[model samples]
Target chain A: MPLPKDETLIFFSKPDNALVKAICGRLIPGSPEDPGAVEAGAHQYIDHALAGYYHSQRTAYRRGLTAINAYSQSQYQKEFVELSNDQQDSVLTDMQKGTATGFESPKAPDFFNTLFQHVREGTFCDPAYHGNQNLVGWKMIGFDGAQVAHFDSHMQVGADQSERTPILTLADMEELNFPAPENGY
Target chain B: MSLPKVDVVIVGCGAAGGVMAKELSTNGMKVVALDRGDFLRTRDVAQLDELRWQTRGELQEPMIKDTQVRWRPDEKTDTIGLPFLMASGIGGSTRHYTTQHWRMLPHHFKQYSENVARYGASAIPVGTGLVDWPMTYEDLAPFYDKVDEEIGISGKAGNINGTIQAGGNPFEGPRSKEYPMPPLLQSTVSRLAKPVLESLGYNPFPGPSSIATENYKGRPACTYCSFCTSYYCFIGSKGSTNVTVLPVGISSGNLEIRPNVRVIKINKDSGGGETTGVSYIDATGKEQEQPASLVILSSYTYENIRLLLYSDINKNGMVGKYFMDHHYPFVWGYFDDTVTNPSTGPWAANVAIDNFNGDNFDHTGLGFIEGGVLEALGGDLQAIAGAGVGSWAVPMPDDTPSFGEGYKQALKKYFRRIASFISQVPSLPYDANYCDLDPVVKDQIGMPVLRITYNAYENEIKACAFMQNKAENILKEMGVAKMKKAGLFTPPTTTHEVGGVRMGTDPTKSVLNKYLQSWELPNLFVVGGAVFPTYFGYNPTHTIEALAYWSADYIKTQCKPGGSLTQYF
Candidate 1:
């Protein structure tokens, strides 16, 4: 369910998208054995969410991204994306602990928490939402996406099931469909 | 628009309303059941998208202005998080319920008397509004069986007409008949805990659930689809009233179900001694009057109290008093060697032990009066939650850092190897915990929203902690590598919302009578969990369904012309 790569950005600007990618990389670092948020295309997922289900968070994302960059500039005279891996962790820790400066409205902690939540959602959500690219999230952790029934074989699972078998989504099942105008955020 | 009058106008056609609708309509009385949501068919609930259904509380009562429920820890504090538990569909919360159908034990009906009889007069907690039920378990036992057949329950009866049956909850009240359907397959959680439970000399039987194991009344059997709770049944297997009694009421040709209709005012006679009917907003959003001889309020607990309070029917300032809810303390752990694959069966496919619940064990010197049923849970699988998306219930192993590589590695390790257990303990109704209208907040429809002032008390906290210890003991015996006991007792958040419009014999002390009939107005009846004076440790749906059938019989046989139904009548 990966979106076509050639498609234009729906919500994020090129710079914002790059910033989100860097943040996603730090939130969950990508690895060969177990791909994390960056490898799962969580930035794209957040962008798509900002365009649709989470349009209200647009200002928060904008200001929060700006604040992260501003704080990075102030602390190290560089953009957040240019920070070293260890430096990036320290910056994010400050943001998570509400210690990072110049963040308002969604303060440092609020922005960091919201960003982390969206990152997790993007990393682990159904690929029908256009995240979890190649079902890497489902594969890294053994989650059978959408099973019609759970038999004894499912309970006997020792390794990641998504790695061994095909993962099901809403598109795979004729019975399931997204009922929209999803309220109650 | 003025609609045609009916014999009964039932507000909130859900768990109790469905049964009442089926019963009264079948008895040849015309019934109109109005709800604020759609009559979603089985096909409407096919999807299991975790983000929408679980995290968003999609099937829950939508957080519109009119459907708002505000909460605070106490009267002085500001309202905190919005507590959304009830649903709006034809089946209400029954649609998304885990279907753990359990009949309250015999002693649960006599909470006050049993404690006094066993441990003298001081056993009852101070300021607790504990009282003996005006009606007995035997009185509702027949109706409980009727509910068993009506909703197609799957269970093994522990006690049948005073004789104890093997493999069933031995502490349960005597039942007149066996369940209509047999129990589902024991889950991996159940299988893992079965020998351990027996070694501890506890009776381990598969819990009773409305889910059918064999096709009955044309509903299919459960598929172990994992989307059982917090999601509706797509295949008509779960005995949601939409597939059960509600259809019977419709097919009987005497029931008229109006969805998306909000009942605003339970109309009363000018004298304030009789119910005329109800004034409501129709499906098209026009205010209308539907006059009837009787009005039944089955709109869950909060709204039931809200409507009565708004209608100025607070007889003893008791309409919104004595609100209570069940205390659910969850205990879970991660295993190193075993992959318990906690994601296979529905929640009902687990075993239940009543040795700790109700008056089964000695509560003589304990800090609490009553205990709860502790069960090793099964198939409480949520992909988003298990994957660590939602903050409500992220399944990271105990002591693992919540972020970075340690978080990812811990979640991956425990995703398939976790074991979870829970206990459902009933919180005693205290004088301080109650529901009233929110003066500051109003719904879009110009009605005052329900403001609940509740706090988890010592009795509930102690009971929950005790059960958490017991569950941890069982998990430790099962040999878990790492374990976590959830912080205990946050009230009015979890489901099992009961009380508020309590039933008692003394008209001065309670809102409704034993038969769920309004004490002041003979023609007005309030059904559902709102009438539970105090809930037992069991899930309240079984009792709610039983009371509906019990009241429906009274409405049919005695609550009519010339049978001393009421002096006014």
Candidate 2:
């Protein structure tokens, strides 16, 4: 019942945070109509994953962050979060089309593709590693928390699919606002 | 450095190594068994967690230490196929495997010749290095029974005394004995699908699992924690060599096991002719020399061949050739109607329908001789199994929200409404798809690891796609609301790597003879999966154990009560 590390926090400047919000909005966009990543808590969840549990993705993560920074610098002549929503959308589209400023670099295209994919994965993966904050992603995808088996009457054909319940969520824990150690080390 | 001389030097302590250690030691021969990994006791395994190992692949062969084999055209220049992936710790891959054992079907021995006669040689995939096994299924039957009895297999008899049964595999080779224990309990998932399977006319029998259902011999019954395959059983319920063989082997003082010793060379005479001993780098990187009258390469499939090729021993220079691995493509279904608990027990649930396994069905007209076993395994909920789901209910086609009121309701409705049906197809060896030495990329000790070069031929692809379709039909017949075939099938590579130093009658054609002895070097024997000429529909643990017993029995008769090494030469 303890809080995560401060380094794990992904509170970007308005410009950069706005860019992330825009990208995540396209990936899963909460409520389909509003299409916002904040509602999914995807940015916060991604920050947590970046700080921990995504060790295998370090190279891709670094490259991706660099690519986004370069795109904002070239296209808007400013940071990504500072750009307007339309401007952010244009930069992302250009990057995906392999025409962004640094996309010509040997590893730039790869870096951009990997970054967007990781962001999407982070937003949607299980909440065990701190992504999908507040069960937003799970609730969106209809996933229950680490259930043992669901092969019961739920697995039958034409059986009533209602009355199903998730195993548990972090919200269910009584000790929610737990304190964190200054340094686990 | 001081040199110690023993009668035999066994290269590993897993399934084959354990058996060789017991056989030679019990026969009054001094045996020195060396393992590259540490000795993990019950205490090491007793602390089980779903997070630390299962989801993280702590038990699997790593891409860093154990590289997967690659396929390339140029043999000398291309470094792609070298360094096949395999487990390195004590008990080797057996420590982490699911332990579903089955002998290669009877026709597997004569597959090449039989297929040629029926389907014609053109039907066989070109470049495939398929060959008749040097020995017949009948020859390995007694040994298989011995291994089954020793390991305490928990399977219901499929064919007792050569009589075909309705539920068991009708295509399995004759067995001298029955399984030591009864099969594990069937899950609710299996029960719900069984009736539909029968109505569709498929033979579903209890899958042969190594997990103990009841107290067998000295081992306890399975606790059904659902953390298997990648996790070791803490209760000694899983029939790994650590629990079944190594214990008894160690009790007899003749078996001297040295863990953390990485064998670097099969030390030959200065002339580089006959093997005299083995030189290994210990855990501290200190070199130690152990001399022996005989050496047994009982390592994993690729490791055994790698060690031999590094030593430059095979007279014909056919050290690494004919590597094979199975093609597994899963078929999954999401049921709109609920029936059973999705997660309940051990790794595999229910039984297998072996109608298409081996030559069970008509192969005379089919393009491929063997097919696969279509079945479902109870899903293990360890971290790897979660695989990113947020909603609990089926998403409406128009639904686009991931988080909000609609999303929460959806997440609550469909979390456990999924089931998977799978296919286990047979893989054959090919000429281009073989194991060989890589000139570059040496291991820590400067010895080249065995490189695997493999590509599934058209026949294999066809067989896999066919089996996948069959699996889909079975799922549909089971009345699943929505079923999807698991696709984007990548090539396979891992612990079950087989063939390379295949067994055959002619020394010019194979490395090992019928008795599992190197035709060129009679005193040196090779055990483990490398001797298998073809892959079966099931896991390789049981067959490897059977071969180990067969090799051990042969070694005891030919090399024991020793008069002289001159007779072998």
Candidate 3:
């Protein structure tokens, strides 16, 4: 599935956008055989969340992105997005260990923690939120998404029933004839 | 606008209020219950969206938009805004709870005396205000049976009238009879670990759950959909107040639930000895007064304390004292040979070993005053919430890379190969651990927000370490290929918070009397986990429900129109 084009950037600036894309590339990098956070529309998920549920972190992201660029310029004489993948990984490792310099209000480790959590959520959360596009993350992790799972025979110890069931999503529940509650909320 | 006076006006239609409404209204007394959030419908949670329900605060109250809770380790430190584990709707936190219903063991009620008898006087920690509950487990056993049957709990009774039974918690307090229904089907993790636990000389049984095993009381049985905790039961099998007692209360005709109405203050009589009514802001943004002959405070622990402190009804300043929570420690194991399909059963701990809980095991030389129950849980391995640091269901070992190719490979390999164990360590009440009204911050309704002053005591920290070691041993005995011990730390989050407005036989140290009625204000009653004297290793929902019923029975029998408060006093 393709990424949604209707999403407008709410929090990330031009430089921050490039930085986020680079970060997603290393955090959940895709190869010819596997899908990653970029393929799951993680950037779009963060972009849409900033306008609503995660609006409180807007200032922190702004400050953290600025510090990352400053650290990148000092170390590599280039912007964060302009660095090689190995260099970007090194910078992220420093931030993760809380040893990165040029961070002020929102600490470097705190920013990394928040960004990493959001990336995970974007990759694995249901597709209703515009993330997990086409359920790539679920497929990668072998999660049969949101089925009315009643496993009487497969619940025995040492049973490997993973291959028996097909993955289902919220959109497919109706066609699959999953039972809905009598009184709707 | 002013509402007509009723027999009783209850605040916060959650666990306690739901029970009180049903009991009082069924007994033909008029009741008006107020809740701050909307009475959510079944369709409001039709989709099992992990991001909205589990990862985000969909079922919980929004800290920024509704109330602000500040927390500080001690009195000398500055407080920061913290998110409390509570919900605001009509059914409250029970709507999203994992439904691990537990009755407090007999010793939990008389801990002060039992500890002294078992370990002598010095065993009682110095500053910990450990006291015996006003009522004993025997006195509340009938009520426990009532709630278990009424709410459709499923479990195997360990002991029935002094006879020990097999395949059950042998340490449990003796019940008058067996459970209303058989236990839920055991998960693969529990089934695999049963023989191992038995070989280690521990009793393992299916944990008591409020989730239905078979269709009873017009609700469907559990579907084992793996979306049990932190999400509404789409099948209406989990026994939340919304699906169980609240509907009965509403059908009684005498009970009126006013949703989206925030009670700001409780109005007192001119002499300040009794409550007359309560003032609230309705959903239309208008101030409304609801007058009643009796008032019951049945909100969550933090709010119950906040409401009492906000209204200045805590005559001796003891309302917000002695706050406690169960300090939780989790351990996970990865098995290469066993396919622990964790996503195919109820999300709660499916089986539990209670041999170490409460005072069942000898704590004579353990250096810790208490121990916790260890259990093998299932179906909580959600995609989004499990991808964080120290998450219980995350299968990544300590040495694994957090992200990239290695992380991807690890996720796929361990996703279905992991099983988790948790220990609910009991937290004792200390003078330093308490709740109070924030002096500076206010909620959206302009009322002073609740502030918590707490840190894990020596007993709790020691207990957590002890339980973690035990958990690791059990996982090793189960022959897991790789084991990971999630180290113990005191986080500000707890779903099982108890004891703010405590009950005691003596009025000097407690806010409520033996019957959960106010010591000073005889007509006022405070129900819920707020009346607990100390935290127990077990989940407090069953005890909370039982206490609510016990208090309602007292109100019904002793505090009638022509009855006198002398018997209670």
Quantify all predictions' global Cα lDDT against the true fold: 0.82, 0.64, 0.81
Extract clashing residue pairs from model 3.
Answer: A184-B43, A185-B41, A185-B42, A185-B43, A185-B44
lDDT of 1: 0.82
Among residues 3 or more apart in sequence or in different chains, the pairs in candidate 1 whose N, CA or C atoms overlap within 3 Å are none
**Candidate 2 lDDT over residue span B401-425, tens digit each:** 3333343343334445556666776
DockQ scores for all predicted structures: 0.33, 0.11, 0.52
Lowest summed lDDT window (length 10), candidate 1 chain B: B560-569
Top DockQ hit: 3
CAPRI band for model 3: medium
Quote the TM-score that chain A achieves in each candidate.
Answer: 0.86, 0.63, 0.85
Tens-digit lDDT string for candidate 3 (B171-204): 8899999998788888888888888888898889
Q: Write the per-residue lDDT of candidate 2 for residues A60-170, one digit (tens) a residue.
A: 655566677777888778876667756766776666667776643435556545545445455444555555555555454443443322443443434422334754443
Runs off by more than 4 Å, candidate 2: A1-60, A72-185, B46-51, B61-63, B66-68, B73-85, B116-127, B271-273, B339-342, B381-383, B388-415, B443-446, B486-490, B562-569
Better of 1 and 2 by DockQ: 1
Models 1 onward score TM values of 0.94, 0.81, 0.94
**DockQ, candidate 3, vs. native dimer:** 0.52
Count of clashes in candidate 3: 5
Ten contiguous residues with the weakest lDDT in model 3 chain B: B386-395
